[model samples]
Target: NAGVIQTPRHKVTGKGQEATLWCEPISGHSAVFWYRQTIVQGLEFLTYFRNQAPIDDSGMPKERFSAQMPNQSHSTLKIQSTQPQDSAVYLCASSLQGGSNERLFFGHGTKLSVL
Candidate 1:
């Protein structure tokens, strides 16, 4: 079966521009997680959804970042007023279900570059 799918493999944004990234998890899976990866920060958990509802968003930037799962198969991450500091790889991972014992399958990710 195919793993998670993330669209636009790369994104280029000017300072203050908006960037929208998409993710489509594997069929029949319910847990979706968003993470930001960079050399200095390593991997940072942005948020997650369990059964289409938000589970945790403690890692999201207080102002410019947000995530949503409107349906079963897909999710989106939106960043407003994108800044140079926001330039990083945004990865989306999914599990069969929410809870322990679920293995995460990651998408190729959307590499965002803010100019």
Candidate 2:
């Protein structure tokens, strides 16, 4: 299996622009998750899907950010009006079973830089 694949390992955008990060989960995996990594928050869970269904997303910012799993194999994280503060390493993870405590394998992550 290819494991989780996050495209555009690095991205740079101007403030007020939009940024979209993509992820391809492992084959046959039922759960895919999104997270943001930063010095302050460490690994902050953003959202996830189980069996291609949206699950919890309370940790995500109410505005300017959104996550979606359109199919079993892939998911996307979109940020509108990107700001300097939004710059961070966006990570995607997946596991065979879906649960908060389940062991997850993570992608290398997409580093977003805003200027």
Candidate 3:
């Protein structure tokens, strides 16, 4: 069975520290995937990938937040100067293809906690 895999099921970082989250999409699936879930904002799209390229990141904060898909097997989300407001369940998902119509396979998520 293959599925998206996110590392560090839980992470704790200090308010000015940095947090790097990893996500390994199913072996064969493609298209960019990253989302953040919080009690106040619910589920929000952070970025989208297609053919290992970032195509959209409008939902991400202009500063301190970035995502990248270096290859077909994995992707990453890094947050700089982490703040308490940055804490959330960072979800990684992939679709059979890149688009809104395709089904998404999501990892359990990496819960980030900032102090």
Best by lDDT: 1
Model 3 over residues 1-115: C-alpha lDDT tens digits? 6688999999999999999999998877878589999999999999988889888899999999988888898899999999999999999998877867888989999999999
Ranking of all candidate structures by their lDDT, best first:
1, 2, 3
- Highest TM-score, which number? 1
> Against the true structure, what is each candidate's TM-score?
0.97, 0.96, 0.96
lDDT, candidates in the order shown: 0.95, 0.93, 0.91
Give the per-residue lDDT of model 2 (tens digit) for 23-66. Answer: 99989889998999999989998998899888889889999999
lDDT of 1 by residue, 81-106 (tens): 99999999999999988769878999
